[model samples]
Target: MNNSNTAFELTIVVPVFNEEDNLERVKQEFDSYLSKSPYRSKVLFVNDGSSDNSQMFIESICKSSNKYSYLQLSNNMGLSAALKAGIDYANTEFVGYIDSDLQTTPFDFDLLMEYRHDYALVTGVRQNRKDSFVKNMSSKIANGFRRYMTKDTAEDTGCPLKIMKTDYAKKIPFFTGMHRFIPALIMLQDGKIKQVPVQHFPRIAGEAKYHLFNRMIGPFKDCFAYRWMKKRYINYEIINQG
Candidate 1:
């Protein structure tokens, strides 16, 4: 049975895809963070149709504490859909995101929470990333191109560690490459975003799903799609409502 007594103020969505090797540590680290979090927080693991034992691990974790819950997709819909599912299902004032690979620590959420009130989205910029040369180079090229095209001014939109008001997150329009345009989409809603430096570590388990094509070439093409959409996006304000 779930701990019905726990009060949840924030939902940290962890999207998992064949990450059975790291779920044990994920449970430990997240549990530690929840124990001392300033806000009453819960972890929601979205299993993106993993063929491994990830689903079993997630189920076990959720059963261990009411602080944890999960959503299992029918098939692998990629990160964008998995994240959108989690965001839509989240019933908290704020929603948080972190990768399951353990490169980014759940503890950095405290750093983001520091500015959560002032900014619509608070994202972490990994300092001294522990990725390979090709991965780093591709990310730089992709991020630079995205900035030039979208003009979102986000230092590291690719950084997986982030927190945003659940309302703004839910308002974001969804698409195939939607994950790459989160900060830009938030900006479309006239939302404020703050990026802060955070620790980055080398991945100890599970293989990275991205490659040169998806990381660099794919985002390069998505920039044009984003530009096209940006011109057509609509927003409004109601000063007088009875």
Candidate 2:
């Protein structure tokens, strides 16, 4: 990794899994944001061991552009692993997470970033999700369960738009489904989290890797893991002046 002459304001991490069809659109949208947005940011594409043409597409994009770059895992490591890799490589002051499916626009980062100054983490909630009934209902059910279990109280845990300080992000313990547990994990470190409404659109291409079982059950199991971590979590603050 090349050290920047100065720290970047934000580094947006996009976890992709066989998203070949949507790759170019993601590129165009992010590229436009980098050029037109108020904040200076870099895009990191974590090609999460995609079996499709995603790896090659990412390689091409990185070769052609300096503003965008990518990292490929030896094999599939899921979203949590991809995000951990991105967070580990992050050299910016703040890091952001978004989906490559194009359902969540990167421009929404503009809104989330505005609140990052006030909170360690700023997340987005879909106002009117453009998804199927089954998809939407399943998400609601899972989110409701998550809220009841963890008491994070955010409207959308699955919304792809989030921005947070890199230092605070690094403190959260890594675990499966850690992506969805960001608010709770941040709270573990006494980090404040903010939520805001953002635009959500339907997926234009590529199949979702997660289904109801994987989305709901998988997170439910991980919620237990989170509770365990919370019980064992350690937090400390300085008591004396520097």
Candidate 3:
């Protein structure tokens, strides 16, 4: 349940799975970000049934400040599900996303916020990623295939630092791999997106959730699923409300 203060203009959603080692750092980074953010913003931690002590950490973090709240899923739903839940629960003009891993810093969110008014979504493209060779290669291949198939031209869909207008975000259909196609999904609704370069860091704690097979094969298959959905995707306008 959300234990928040006044309504915020932006709600930053951090999807947590089993990042027990990283929650304290997450709170610190967010505290710094929210304290200096130009727009009023708060954070929501979507704990996806963390078998570790992540839930306890989240609870303690939220209790310490009204700027934070969290939702705990019943089971270990994937990242896509966690993200969807956060978006749904957000009651703000803009919804932001960041991973708990801290590969991308929450401070870079300031860069994306610059274009928040003009674009439906502003996403970060990680600069000089600090992952292993295999992970980097698989991500490159997957990103190439996704762009080729979806033609979304999203430079780094997996960067995990994004801010999108809440209305556009809620319109996106949820799927197991919806996280990879956020730009494409927004484009399907005739929404514009801006991609900006953001700082990248090596993971200092916890384990990387993705590997070569899931990173490469999952997006490849999801690309087909996205293509199928795109062909039948619906868009409409209401010219009159009288």
TM-score of each: 0.96, 0.96, 0.97
Model 3, 124-175: lDDT tens digits are 9999999998989999899998999999989999999999999999999989
Q: Write the per-residue lDDT of candidate 2 for residues 122-202, one digit (tens) a residue.
A: 999998889988889999998998888888987898898899899998887987788888998888888888999999999
lDDT of 1 by residue, 123-207 (tens): 9999999999999999999999999999999989999999999989998988878899899999999999999999999999889
Worst lDDT run of 10 residues, candidate 3, spans 1-10
Each prediction's Cα lDDT score?
0.91, 0.88, 0.93
TM-score, cand. 2 vs. native: 0.96
Winning candidate number (TM-score): 3
Off by over 4 Å in 1: 1-6, 240-242
Please list the residue runs of candidate 3 whose C-alpha ends up more than 4 Å from where it truly belongs after superposition.
3-6
Residue 135's lDDT in candidate 1: 95
Better of 1 and 2 by lDDT: 1
Q: Answer with 2 or 3, whichever has the higher TM-score.
A: 3
Score residue 112 of candidate 1 by CA lDDT: 95
Clash pairs, candidate 3, are none
**Top-down lDDT ranking:** 3, 1, 2
